[model samples]
Target: MKNEPVRSEAVGISEEILRKWEAKGVSRRDFIKFCTTMTATLALPLTFAPKIAAALEDKRLPVIWVEYQSCSGDSEAFLRANQPTAAEIILDIISLEYAEVVMAAAGHQAEKSKWDAMEKYKGKYLLIVEGSIPTGEGGVYCTVGGESAVESAKKLIKNAAATITVGTCASYGGLPAAAPNPTTAVGVRDLVPGATIVNLPGCPVNADNLTATLVHFLTFGKLPAVDAIGRPKFAYGKRIHDNCERRAHFDAGQYAESFDDAGHRQGHCLYKLGCKGPEAFHNCPTIRYNEGLSWPVMAGHGCIGCASPGFWDTMSPFYRRLPQVPGFGVEATADKIGLGLVGATAAAFAVHGVASAFRKGDAMESDKVKVEE
Candidate 1:
């Protein structure tokens, strides 16, 4: 009789993790699929799937999640992660040493847990911050356990293996740091100069990105490559417009003039209605949200450019169209340029199509001659 493979257990994965996976209805095949999905999400080749799986099974990173001045929407999103589920990530994949939002401890006990984790993990744990740090009035605006936000962050970040700032609030001061900033809110990068911070900026960052970042670090022992502004290139390499569903409409010079217009009903481009897809750099259109269901534009709403720096000020007023398309002359409007380019683009495609057909015919004739010979 042939022996069946028992891979997960034989590979040194803890029985506890396997139990948790079983309880969560995640089979070994499901786990492998998850690893493959993560490999692809990180823009890594499928061959890296086994490496990612090994890392996840072997390394349980110690994580300390902190929050300061802003809504807890990012934490909420983190909790609702469906790919691995928050329970599996926190309990099985990572040793979440301290998280004020989810940990059972509270008050001084909570503070003690944080301090203890900091001391125990010391220079080894990952620090994940959710909101911006308030710098006004001696950082009195946001305090945790009698320590100001700045003071706590400074101490915590000093010895961290890496710091990940989730949400636009934590990445670029977000809404709190917008115009006439009262609390003088600033992001982790602003608070800690000379520190390498991985930024995942979104109104409420997609949990999958955060998970992928963690997995990348675990798999490779270093953070993924970042763009000029420190966002992972794999996730923010291209503008949303590059892969937007309405790109054809935009290229064809079709756009929605208002919220309830015929163009919108027919799924036309939202650029004229103030879509910032052309300027915003993110994987929202590809990775999507709510379990790969739909994104804002897909839901009939224009992109508000939440992923870009200081989008609240730069991309507003949200409903007003940009004067000119990016990478184009200032005098020419987007629709005008689109109209002019549409004709040229169509002509070029027609020419290319004809040439391709001719090439195919020539190839067929050559193949027939070779077969006869």
Candidate 2:
């Protein structure tokens, strides 16, 4: 077994940092509330709020974010995060030692900074890989500092405490591995099979999940409990359909057959249009994107199941039902439909039990919360 991190608050927030943030219009109260929100997101006891506060204040943990075969969408999502805001993320959370897209330094300087940080933080820093690794042609498809993506990841991840695969690309090869998969793109787990990796998959992952996972790591000094695919169970435990806002409509058999139809305008369930929520596990419905404003389904689009396995291929034919899933099959009996709905309803109730642990909480307290436009 690996040795656990010895917890301490020695590196917590300093007065100077607080003063700097205060000048930026963030009051101490707002800061505490944000910490409380992070605590909520982690489903940690309220008592742990102060602990999270202390950890963020400490800011001793270093992170190295690398992009491989990707569109940099995940990095953009991280920067656009609204719940706590990206500025707050950079100033208050983990020390981002190196990132290819964001760092000011480039060329040899950027490469030096990364290697230096890795050497300095060895076996302690968190490694975040934001894209898939292309193994084709000696991994010549994607290179940084003259090193292939596979080579770079292998070098860095080996010395890190834990790894986080931030987007569908990094998690499961995403679009890069779709169809013929010319690049032979594969996820971080496949490339570094021995490393402990937490996959947060989506076209561009929800930033809140990234924040919560980081908090969990800081709080426990270890990785959070994960599903079979190495997704944190706290975040990926429930099927999106189970907690969808249109679930009542689905239960009542009010489905929209087309985007232009009256049912869609009426906010009917998107099952008929091939919503993949039933088979997908993610908190998009509850977490929503852009500071809890709205999600794809809420916007009248069927879930493409971006967070599910092999989504690019398996969840395709975007506007049609998947061939025939087990419970929601074409030949399913009436009893099966009733049982499925009943189970979905029951799962809906249980979702809160887990959701409350880490959800950003405004919704937990009030239904009056409006989506940010």
Which residue pairs in candidate 1 have backbone atoms (N, alpha carbon, C) closer than 3 angstroms, thus clashing? none
lDDT of model 2 at residue 51? 68
Q: Whole-model lDDT for model 1 versus the true structure?
A: 0.79
lDDT of 1 at 302: 91
lDDT of 2: 0.76
Q: Number of clashing residue pairs in every model?
A: 0, 10
- TM-score of predicted model 1? 0.82
Query: lDDT by residue for model 2 over 175-244, one digit each (tens)?
Result: 9998799999999999988688899998899999998898888877888887777787667777777789
Model 2 Cα shift for residue 138 (angstroms): 0.9
Shift of residue 362 alpha carbon in model 2, Å: 42
Model 1 lDDT per residue over 86-176, tens place: 9888877899998878889999999998999999999899999999999999999999999999999999999899999999999989999
